[model samples]
Target: MLYFSKMDGRRWEPLQHDNQSTVAADFRLRPKRRIVPCRPRSLYHKRSITMATTPRNPRSKSGNKPAVAAPTGVIPVYDSALMQERRQRILDETRRVIEENGIESLSMRELSKRANVAQRTLYNAFGSKDRLVGLVIQETYLTQLSRMKFATAPDTMEGVIERLARVCMHFGRKRNYLKAVMDLYFAPTVHRDTITMMRELSYGNSRPWLLQLEQRREISPFLSREQIEGDMTDLAFSVMRKWAIGDIGVARMADEAVRGFLVLAAGATTGEAQARALRTLALRKRRAAGPATAVEAAGMADMAGVE
Candidate 1:
């Protein structure tokens, strides 16, 4: 059976046709609109492209997990200490070259020379310059988070502030690392997707740990957990942006950050732990003349032959 359709602008009017197949063939030959087959829902979930109307999961209303949980369960794979050291070397070098010459001028040839690793290692570790930078930033961010962990203040309010304060001070020493993070966070068009992942990892991984911060003696009892969470987030971004643009010196960046954080977090009854941590941090800053190389600051007396 064949049908003829006459188009009047956007409207189509059906007409009687003796040969349906012939009319259909003619219609196919002259397409009025392009028709494309949609990919299966499984394929869409696999790609993980987020859209406003894209139902992340058909089964889950909250869209918690995708239709399928990602392999490895959204955590880092276990690697031996030796493997971690090797990767850390690659990351440190990647940070050095990119900061020295900017991301645009970065080359594997130069990175290979500077990073003190074989060119193939760079290729194997990260597939491309973009990914190399991404991993470098990710590793640096993770390092800060790792340093924040505390046995004493597992989930206390003072403990949370103390951890945040310590991490801020630690990162404030690494000029190269700080510059690279600022670049990644601010460079939207250059590395948008990588930026998204970095932020997600930063916030997502810390949420569970943040529950410990609630109702701490150092934090305002007047503030709700929701308010504290929102304020801390904005404060972190503000400090980073200020440091990125060179508006604040390294020591002051950390100082004002911790102080400002204390002010925001301070409750009527300030804990001894909070007061003691602040004193220790301030003393460390005063003892140091200025920012030193990552190696030197680590109390590494010599970094002989390191690129």
Candidate 2:
């Protein structure tokens, strides 16, 4: 007799037989096993598991829910009415300090104290002292520049001259503050943003007036709008800078600015506009020379009488 073992899927099973023929017959009587393929887990299933495990409202206490917290790292927008009033107050105080004590005397500590704000608030609002002063200049000086009108004068070249004269007068009224501002403006280490803001304010205010001149055909067709506007703006700024630096009196600044404008306009006009510009320049030159000529002639007469 012989006995054999065979695997029956889960375990081995013994076959009892009397001979080798019986053992082969027992092995053929075993049943076959079936296999089933496995399916993969899905994204939704994983998320469901995560949600089931995570605590809902982790920060909330038992029974009552906590208030939602504000998101971190968000910058605040400064355009609200309250923020605008605060900003205006800060600017007004800055202007007052600069006008009363000069720009050199201005300090963030003093300004904050005067404005009833923390020193950190000043830094947060303006980033730096240069920026604060630049804003003051823009708000005070540039605002006036933008509001200037030729109510009495027509939309002609003469109106432009009057506007320049008014600008010189305005600068003269704030000599101390403007002088300091000019020094800072021309400094080698001044912030580029400050320079850009000042330049843009000037150029922006001038553009509308220049556009009016262009529409009226007072500006030359040969020159681009940019060329005419830029030339005139540069001339006006140069004159104002001279006045600000104490290099010239307000009267002289006005005269030089008017002359420069007329000269530039003369080259940048055609037809009747060109003739008018030339005539204005010639008349100014004659007026400027008249007194000097009279003085020289009087001196010569005195010399002859003495002789």
Candidate 3:
């Protein structure tokens, strides 16, 4: 059933037809002035329903294509759970490669093979090796932060120092990957970019730990209230670098010395334990340096003056 309708500019003359189809009634030309009532069944029978009221192109006055609105918010298109698992797998493989064969061995192809993921997948997950390493460092920091719990205020400074020492010692003993991470952290400029990124990536994870420690007077007692922050950050970086480079021996000894200083600073607890620990540590460190024979002395003096 076809019906002929006369058009007068933007208006149309109603035509008498014998068919059930209302397609002709919906053949609108001036979209702004035209209004056609549509039923759900009409939309199902003929997909010509206009859901949006906004004109496709207000400026264009005459175009056939419909305008699309831009999407809002940061929405992930990929399967989030699967993407997370894949990302984790890549990070694990990256750490393994760095730990076993050093940072030089960390290649996209090698990581892809180890992770059983394609090169494209790795690229999609982590833009590059530096990014992946940054993520790995971030995850490591987050994992460590999760384990550390802070007290509001330790009874004595010595106890606080002892607890801090135990935490450092335990971390040093556990993480064998510290050496590799330390190497990157102290590497030259070209490699230092990754370390900088790692620091930024881990800022979120570490800030809370520092804040929690600050909430407790335990941290303030060690340094002036204002000086505490700068001192604590320096101490944290120093401890991390030391442990990473196998300088834990000095740190272990320093721990005992720190305890003594804490006692003097706190004026609480007897300084006997700290005193004994410090003496034993000092003697051991010097002895451990081996007999200071004349040959070692001359070599040390020569080397010290060379640079």
Candidate 4:
């Protein structure tokens, strides 16, 4: 109904299509609010921009201005439960490592990994691998200590000697533990710390047992308390040394030697000289029964018959 007219060709525009076609038909649609982009700024903050760069704690060496507490190394702090669990875990892992690879193979990182703990935890708890080895020795000593059944009760000198023998034999049976001790002994200068640590730990762990052993008058008759203490300590370490060196084999001679030492220590002359006399008599009998030429034995027998 209108006349056709020519317009300016310079003006152009694109047709707008519904955006809903791009969205899934089943999807629920909502009108979105338009958002204007802006740079974030907090208005409530009081400090000026220059004040932030100036440093609030200008007097402190750290320059934080507010100041923080410094740590003191003089006092030792420990969490008892964490320490207990960590110690036990380390010990268990150490034993396993010693059994699997050998004592020399127990590296700090390897041990930490084996124990499922961090290497720092091990260093913080034990200082070094040498100290860790020392703790392992302590664990071994504790295990052996537990097997000593006669620490409290004693009936006779023979019983005490038997108990000592049993303890020595039981310790030697644990080959890995003996190897660990030997390793501690021969470890390099840096590792020697563990040896000294073990000496202290061993002496510490034995204090109570040694006290109980001293109370037995039948075990130490002539030796004064101090003398007995020194002797017992020496004897214990001597046996440990022997065990480390693998010197005590399955021989009756070692047992007899141990028995003789116990007899001497217990002062058999005081209460039971008769036992020693009987031992001497048995020795004499064995000497008389020694193997010899038949003619020589007969000649000696005939001379004895003439006498």
Candidate 5:
């Protein structure tokens, strides 16, 4: 006698056994048996088979598996309003902490305590300490940049001087905090993303005005926008760095920045614009020839006004 056993529900295989095992045997050969559907022996067997064939739910209450991940390119939304509020509070506290204690003294635990948020929440929102610091610096710069109402004025060499003066005044107002931030921004070990973001912010703010100047023919058509912007940015940053490091006062920083920009612009401008740049450069040099008192320096800064 030949018998078959169910393999998976779809197929069966022949089972061989000795005569003593089953107590029966067919000595004569017979035709091969046809395959038939398997039938469960009892309700318990049927239930077991059904359970074995069914797919499992990852999020089922009876299973320990985690919930399925969101589909590709799908972002999960959370409590947006509350998260924004929390982020704002954290940023405010971060600015205060960095301003009072400097970046080197900023502790995540202390910041969390100050902001009344969990340490994990900080990491969740900003990813890392370097990122949080970058955010604070970026926010501060943007806030100051936005406050310069005169920034929207006509793009001219005078407008450029005014903008640099405004920037210097902004830095002067937040000297302690910005100095520390600038230190971190220029550090050799600073995070690449943070530095890249800082540079992009600088470039983005300047490019539009530079482009406008180019369009009006205030900037020379021979000069590429990138070259003009790059040179001006480098000069501005060098002067700002000197101010941040206490090597120069805000007045001198503004004067130097304006002078440097004018020198570069003079080379890249034509017609009346070139003449204006050279004239401004000469005036700035004459003003810087003598050592001025605090009041005089302040007056000079006021003269190179933003509006």
Candidate 6:
């Protein structure tokens, strides 16, 4: 036990102590620092025992390791696999919303709820709803285009024409996708990526087939390979755009597109025999597709009225 009391003139007299050296040892001990407001550069944290030996995290505001800022903006992208999955989930939900309700009806808050992503994360991923919609539309266009594989360049002109006709008929069956492609086509400003994609699809995918047509002398001498490709691309787009918006039915759109390509190919055929041969095969194929159902018959009547 040790005890001290004031004696005189700022001098402390020991009332009771076993050894004076114990008092000197007590004087040698360092006092623990009390945490207080730190410099602005350093955040508030538990006061450190050793300032020289370690670093900044000790001054974290939460009294833990320094918090990392969540990622912001579109480009470099999310590093967390979980966050990446969340972003993709948002995109998939957006696509489903677009497919079911259309892009105009999509809402960030509703989508955030559906996708289990915070609204902030969606904004960080896409910048705006329009940008997100544009990406969805582009994905849609590419997906539909993927169904029309432009890889198989056939040896026969009819084979190529048949495949091209099927591309239009594919759209004819998937009226929704056709409408989406047309929507992108008519409004290039909103869906610029889709426009770029369509253009790329037209040339990069279709040109090789046209070149093959030229090599086989299946292209009309009157029209260059360029003209043939351009004419058919424009014709299919024009007809499909009408079909997409319900100006024409699937049957009429397919009829026009297939017939238009046949007429174009007719000009390019090397001989009447080959021309007749291709036209015969096309007609046989059409018959094999079965008799015009009531829908087709009604569509035919509509075409006749228009004519």
Best by the TM-score measure:
5
Q: What is the Cα-based TM-score of model 2? A: 0.62
- Which candidate would rank higher by lDDT, 3 or 6? 6
Q: Measure candidate 5: CA RMSD.
A: 15.9
User: In the order shown, what is each candidate's alpha-carbon RMSD?
Assistant: 15.9, 18.8, 21.1, 24.6, 15.9, 21.8
- Cα lDDT of model 2 by residue, 69-100, tens digit: 43322224688998877888999999888888
- Give the per-residue Cα lDDT of candidate 2 at 104: 84
Candidate 6 residue lDDT tens string, 160-184: 5444555555545555545655775
User: Tens-digit lDDT track for model 1 on 1-307?
Assistant: 3233465333333443676423422332223465888988886676667868955453545666645433321333437997678777777877777656656677899778776778976665565566678877777667656644343343443444444554556666666666666676676554556665656654542344445444343444565655655665667767877987789876566556655555554432246535654554465467664322222233222211111
lDDT, residue 185, model 6: 69
lDDT of 6: 0.60
Model 5 lDDT tens row, 32-133: 457898767784465444445777565646688865655432323557898788898999999998888788788999999999999977876777787888
Tell me the TM-score of each prediction against the true structure: 0.46, 0.62, 0.44, 0.50, 0.65, 0.52
Model 4 regions lying over 4 Å from their true place: 1-80, 147-156, 185-223, 250-257, 263-307
Error of 1 at 234 (Å): 3.6
**Ten-residue segment with the worst summed lDDT in candidate 5?**
290-299
Give the better candidate number (4 or 6) by TM-score. Answer: 6
Cα lDDT listed for each candidate: 0.56, 0.68, 0.51, 0.53, 0.69, 0.60
Per-residue lDDT for 45-97 in model 4, tens only? 56666644655552556665764433322212466988788788888889788
Off by over 4 Å in 1: 1-89, 98-105, 112-128, 141-152, 190-192, 204-209, 213-231, 259-307
Q: Candidate 3, overall lDDT?
A: 0.51
Q: Summing lDDT over every window of 10 consecutive residues in candidate 6, give the lowest-scoring window.
A: 298-307
| Candidate 2 runs further than 4 Å off | 1-76, 142-149, 153-155, 204-206, 216-222, 289-307
